[model samples]
Target chain A: MTNAPIFERMALIGIGLIGSSLAQAARQRGLVKEIAISTRSEATLRRAEELGLGDSYSVDAAVAVEGADLVILCVPVGANEAIAKWIAPALKKGAILTDAGSTKGSVVAQVAPHVPEGVHFIPGHPIAGTEQSGPDAGFPTLFDQRWCILTPPENTDPDALEKLKAFWQGCGSDVDLMDPKHHDLVLAIVSHLPHVIAYNIVGTADDLEAVTKSEVIKYSASGFRDFTRLAASDPIMWRDVCLNNKDAILEMLARFSEDLSALQRAIRWGDGDKLFEMFTRTRSIRRSIIEAGQETDAPDFGRHSGD
Target chain B: MTNAPIFERMALIGIGLIGSSLAQAARQRGLVKEIAISTRSEATLRRAEELGLGDSYSVDAAVAVEGADLVILCVPVGANEAIAKWIAPALKKGAILTDAGSTKGSVVAQVAPHVPEGVHFIPGHPIAGTEQSGPDAGFPTLFDQRWCILTPPENTDPDALEKLKAFWQGCGSDVDLMDPKHHDLVLAIVSHLPHVIAYNIVGTADDLEAVTKSEVIKYSASGFRDFTRLAASDPIMWRDVCLNNKDAILEMLARFSEDLSALQRAIRWGDGDKLFEMFTRTRSIRRSIIEAGQETDAPDFGRHSGD
Candidate 1:
């Protein structure tokens, strides 16, 4: 671990999976001299303290960010507006205010309103997460080799942006900048849609009249288990993502439903050629993802311990 | 490895993922004294031989099954009829014939007519596979802790069924038995629909106007990558599954689409409670799958190296 801190002090609001993981990663690498952790729930704040995630813990979001040079809003997208209002008064001058929310447009819409005179408001999303949530589910290496996309507004201070990039890099992430709208669209297709689809499929399986739930669980290794992981993500977090990123997710859902309809027609008509083509083409995308090092080459999504 | 073989000789037709994995597992555990591997492709036959997956190799299914006490048809479901016809005459009179096809109902319908008298026709599906296929992809422990479901005809010889069960157990799979139709319905929800949805979503993302394909690959760790693994599964195998198990797949697909539509409506209406309820329920189902010992408890589906 480095002896010197990247920032004098850092504050993390809402110490769940992403927030707790950031704390661990930052602390492990000595990214911050002093860490302040806060959550709306006193129980979670106490739990974060018990985990030794930060040097100080508080239930007041404003109190946590009072002296911190960096403040990360780790709450759900829907809570951004309220948290922003509560903490706006306490944000130190020139502090880099950022968020680790899934949806950037909503974060911008919700929090950009109360931006203090000099604080840098940069919205970011690390392209990393486990289905699990809460502080206990987090670890230091969660962001390793993952992409962290930043959506900074125009006319923002580049120096502050560079510093934020360095901090994410220090935390084991590759940084990329994208427009907030583009970030939402890309994430909608890549993350939000996938989660919604997974939740729906599992729900469908659960509601099956002929196939029992036990059978679904027993036979899940046949592919159903993969979706269940994403479906098992934090309900409140996902609910906020759905509500806050409504338009982008709904748009992707429409495209997905459209493509599904065409595929359904192919299956209904026994168009083996079409089915084969679609199935074969999609295989290459997985290969591309592997080649790009975005995914493990280990077969079966690396779920099985065996090769 | 055990010195005593479970069977005198075993024949494997179609040396792909299932066939090759069976060869390695069976040979490693001494489940069969001699293994004969057959594929329609001479190149694959040579590759299987190169991998040392069997004691002998052949292109002719008939030649492969000759004198073997057990024969497992590992080809796609659509090819069952022709292969059964080709190998029926050469099968040993009391040989136990089975399959590892995903769809049991179609396998029984297609292969039963060609079975010679005194032969046991038990259809089975080992709910174990990786995205990668072919001779080189096989590993000895592919079936470890996985379920191998058997769907036997009402008149299937008990001794032969027991022998097959023992062989799977030797290969490290828990065995379950169900009626062939029930197996089809269960797999329709657990296997077929998941693959179809994966393929559809990848197609949807591929056809996106705003998001580039590279963006999808780069940000895949967000969630889309999970679906891609299933989408990368062997095209021929999945295509045949869709064709052979049409009705059940269609039914499941309908259910899935209906559920997805309702979820979409909830998202549009900003029904956070509805979304939260659905998401929470699905999380417990994932826990059920983990508790049932069908899935790994590692978060992020154990994709990440760190917990």
Candidate 2:
């Protein structure tokens, strides 16, 4: 049986991976009656049209958001303020305005001032993605079984909040509500820290004079390739994440560096027990993640043998 | 169309993941006429027998090595010295002795002193494994398309080294030869440092007082889950690697920490261009790895949609 549409019109401000995926998911699941897609680049908008990702496409953010009941800013967090200002006047009355950026506190700070009256301003982040980006990297099932966290302002109306949560649910995501500040802190440790570490380690490998780049690529399967996937994430998006989540990210980085120094000292002293203890404790966290259905149970992420 | 066996008798001194996989691969490819397995623990030896991983199973290391023309020490690097001392007298005069440990310098230093006259001692590392350990974690194709680096001591018998290389090739691996010291340095950056960084980041996440463990686990799919695969690797094996490859690992860790400091500075100072440049450069390495057949090209390591 088909479900009724949750919103009359859902406008995606940037037709990148997240925007394209949302359009496909909303359309395939009958979550929205019409999907209006927009991006600054004419070629990308034409490609989105060719893919039939939305009912309408435009290069102007205002034109895309006009008469839309749901407007999602899916651009990089760095581009939020400009798009928010450009589309604020065109946002329909009583529309739910949200975002799919990774950092929430910054998005609220950048977009809240420009939001029109009667528009419900909520910030969101989908805890799901692939290494690749761009519109072609999206799929209809990208949000299945993934979490979409919402950080609504304190004065948000309950009906608007409920509707947005229901809309995400219809697109096959579990919804959680969190304070924007707390969201930034938690994401710093879980998401930002990992990406920063991956990028740093890859940069270190790339600059090694003793070890050639060819050697790193040849032997990456041993361990190095695991970090490359995270390092290969969109540069603009990650740059914005690092810039916007500065305080929390810096705090997490400081802690990680401190711990790494202790580990380095342990190795210098040949303390095998300390190393083993640290390695063993982390295994349980991955186990819990797998049991919670947040990660794949397949060994090496099921890269081999497809098991 | 089948080739003749490379060695008349093959002795595997530790029946863990590497040893068990070698047993299966050698047997499946007809690389040896007879296989003998041994481990220090009686339970492990019995388990190896139950799995029929070898033609004969023994608890005594010397008994397994007697009359074997090819002896591979598959234990942790720290255990190489004692095992080498124990099995030195039993190894045949013309036998080729090797290991599958991650650290080559330490393996050479530990296993070389005990090699009897005319015994060809070659330290080898197969750059392949999963996070799982023990016999049940092994499969015949574990080394398929993987590189196996052999660090042969000076003046090693050419015929013996050729035989060892041919055996690994039969098991579906390309073999590279290098000096023991260089192998350790190369692995420190490509394999050991990545694992150490992964372990450190996971430790940092686990000890965070600001973020609950439940929250970290719940939001791990964002980016944290990628590091968990490497963090969940066999603790004992990794511990041995840290202790045995002390100098090289310390050098790589120092480089990694330095790069991380610069990255942190970029983030704190709002240097978005620097962050973007660093993130953009590492993407090409993953692409090169995929092109080299060292990594899976599927997005997210083929975890979703199985592309």
Candidate 3:
């Protein structure tokens, strides 16, 4: 058993779903000796304190970062620069700083300039979350068996990168290292595009005057209910995701739209073969995801939970 | 107690997910006196027999429907025409014939020509399903609290319609009667378009070269897995749904694409207000679905068993 404490004092600059989850996971596994929590609002900070999420809680980022060996900014991507500037003076000289933002390139660009000389600034994204938000909506198992991608600036301390990797591994995630730009591109295709599509489709269903709102709700179990969950995610967080990752999202959207047009044409022409071929190809991916243990094999939302 | 037997003998032609669920529901509730099961393959018929799903099993639809008081065709939409022709000669006099097909307009056109003079041909769709298929992928509660929409042709007998409505009610679903064209339009936006969108997005994620296939699977809990469940549904069934409901699906697809493009433009121009406004409005529809008992209010895929 490795008894190395990843951090003596860890500062979590935002105590929302991701931040609280990280704090819980670290606390449960004894990965940190003490954890300090901070957020913009006193209400959320008080809630985090009430939940016993950290050893100390404060509304000031600088106060939270004092004497911390590792500092993680778990705020929205758009808030990185301000938080980084606010906490820069109090950050320990040799401490490693990272983020759990969805978009990496923008986060790095916003935070790198504010970092002090000796602090290692590495931006990371733990590609895991629930549709819920806030301090109360977190659990230690949230990151279990999930992927945590780290994007370190070139020529930064290799020792700091490995330490961060060890920390994430202790929290029960597989660590992956990639260039910030590549990470942004990949997430834009896999994560951001899907969310944008889901929001748009739900909006489309809501605007339909012919289909009574009651009818849509009644029959949503067929397929539309799945999209509703994603569409119901935090609007501000998603808006930041879209605005920060514009180029890759736009590129993926263009490709998706082109493919959709082909599908529409096939439907219009009654080309059953084309539609069948496309639908058939998509099924194999789901199987692969299941086989990889990324999803439950239970049929229909695992309705047979007791049996 | 009202103990009127809905039908002396009911022939269910196609013992798959929906068909078998109806068999179980009917058997458990004593809705039908006898059920004659028929499918294209002998193996599925044997499985259905082993599961005690019906009283008798047959590979021939004609043999299965002989002397039956009511016939419910539960095959894929693409097979409706062929099954209709096969069972036309054996349907009993004054029997009510209906289908549980997902698409209404196409099934009506395909099955109407083969209906005998004394038979009442009504088309219905039970808007409920799980991602599983085959005989074992069914349960007694599949139809409970679901909407069962029926589309009867003009000049159809009232007694026949009333009997069918009573039969569905006994199986635990409230029945709605509407025109076939209108049913097609309502389902196009609610069901067909959502499934197609899910399949397309899953396909897009699978095709991404930047994101390793494993990464997509590892991080799927971040909204992508929800789409995978819908995409994993029976490919043949969805293909037929797209082909059978062509015009309405095409119109919905067009509207969805237009809305998606406008959202894409908003993101490109950094219009956070537009994105936030749209995302916020879509959340209420999800709330309405929960209020209507179509979905659970449990957050994050209902990870918590009780909310």
Candidate 4:
């Protein structure tokens, strides 16, 4: 745990999963002296206040950002523009402004124009979250051992970027800097496309007439249950991700579909060797992920995975 | 744990994940007295014996099944036909013969012709497995709380079917009966399609030119890690499943592709509401699975997940 505060005062624009998690993690590590949480929903604002996730809570984004040296937008990508405009007037000079959106390009474009001259704007995405959302769904350890990618504009202050890196490090994340567009592309394959595929398959299963929805749930332990976890993610967040990362997501989806067509063709043609070879090659990638410390070496992704 | 042995001598035809797990679960639960393990590969049979997975081991299927009251063909679906013909002469008259194959219709069609008049041929599939394979991957608790679907022939004797049900129950499985065709359709959606999708996406990531494989591996915790587990499953087992259950798998794949195209269109058109609706509907299915006890209520499918 950190012993010294990195930021004197921090303001969070949304009190959802990422926001609440950041609050909890930062508070536990003493990364910030004061956390001012603000959200559009009054109910959610009250809930965050009750959870004591921050030193102060308000429904006004501008009010929360006043006097804060650090302002982080933790809302869906679609909501970043409005919040940026709303808080632009109250943003403290020299405050490091950042975001935890899934798509960095869209978030940077949406929020960059409104940042004050002295405020440093850096776009970031912490590649960690569960299927659940909301204030109660967060915990202090959500960011532990996770990768946080930073996408700062070329003219941004180096000192501010380094401080933001250290702040995420204090929250237990390893930060890597990259171009916003490149981050969008890498994340399209690694996160956005995977979520789309999961949501698609779950929808397909729900529409099946030959197999009842009940049977899908009953025998879901087979494999479908794994997809359900990703499918159950917050709809608004995912919807924003899909709409914001459209081009990159579609490019990845096109490539994925082409590969899937080949796979489907091999299955249709009774090409056992092709199927066997492809399946064999994919197995090594999983081993590489496990060896890279991105995945557990636990067999079946661990015993708690419904057998 | 069961104290009484259900069968005097039980023979397993292959020593892979399913075969080894059955041996361990049966022995721990006292469901079988003398376990006889067999495989075409001398190495696997030796490994099974090295793991003390059986009372006896043989590379010859006929030799292993001799005088066994319970014979389970645990080989890949494509090998079931040949193994059935080879072991037909050695199976005991009143023995309960079954299988742990993924595709039941093909298993029945290929192996049913070789079953003798007095021998009871009740094909079954224990819907329990880990991504790992081979004799060393087996554990006694693998079958606990998992489903085991039995696809007995229409003319099967009641007493023998009941006995096989008891044997599986002793090993800690909830048994369900269904037609061979119906089982294939249910499994195509629940197990086979998910595996195919998982394999395809992992292959897509591996073939990308812009994103380095290391980048994908480093940030896999985002979403790609979940698919890797299913994609890492045994190649031969999955290949045989694809070939044997081609029609049902193709049907499910077609449905899945159609649904995915609509999702792609929604993203391309910036239809956030449509995407939101689909994501929301899929979330309820995951909740239903958890309520049905098929998934853990633990956020992110339990904390053991490598996030």
Q: What is the lDDT of residue B208 in candidate 2?
A: 87
For model 1, what TM-score does chain A reach? Answer: 0.98
Tell me the spans in candidate 3 whose CA falls farther than 4 Å from its real position. A1-4, A303-307, B1-4, B303-307
The candidate 4 chain A region of ten consecutive residues with least summed lDDT is: A298-307
- iRMSD (1 decimal) for each model: 0.9, 0.8, 1.3, 0.8
lDDT of 4 by residue, A1-307 (tens): 6578999999999988899999999999999999999999999999999999998888999999999999999999999999999999999899999999999988878888888799999999999998889999889889998899999899889899989999999999999999999999999999999999999999999999889999999898889999999999999999999999899999999999999999999999999999998998998899999898777787766754445
Candidate-wise lDDT, in order: 0.91, 0.92, 0.88, 0.92
Our model 1 lands, by Cα RMSD against the true structure, at: 1.5
Taking all chains together, the TM-score of candidate 4 against the true structure is 0.98
Candidate 1: global Cα-lDDT? 0.91
Error of 2 at A19 (Å): 0.6
Question: Candidate 4 lDDT, tens digit per residue, B1-307?
Answer: 6478889999999989889989998988888899999999988888898899999989989999999999999888999999999999998999989999999999989999999989999999998888989999888777788889999898899999988999998888899999999999999999999999999999999999999999999898899999999999999999999999999999999999999999999999999889999999998898899898777888876754445
By the TM-score metric, which is better: model 1 or model 2?
2
lDDT of 4 at B28: 84
User: What pairs collide in candidate 2?
Assistant: none
User: Per-prediction TM-score, please?
Assistant: 0.98, 0.99, 0.96, 0.98
RMSD of each: 1.5, 1.1, 2.1, 1.3
CAPRI-wise, candidate 3 is medium
DockQ leaderboard ranking? 2, 1, 4, 3
Question: Any runs in candidate 1 off by more than 4 Å, and if so which?
Answer: none
What is candidate 1's lDDT per residue for B1-307, written digit by digit as tens?
7757868889999989889989988988888999988999999999898888898889988999999999999888899999999999998988999999999888888899999998888899999998888888888888998999998878778899999999999999999999988889999999999999999999999998789998999999999999998999999999999998899999998989899999999999998899999998988888898898877888776777622
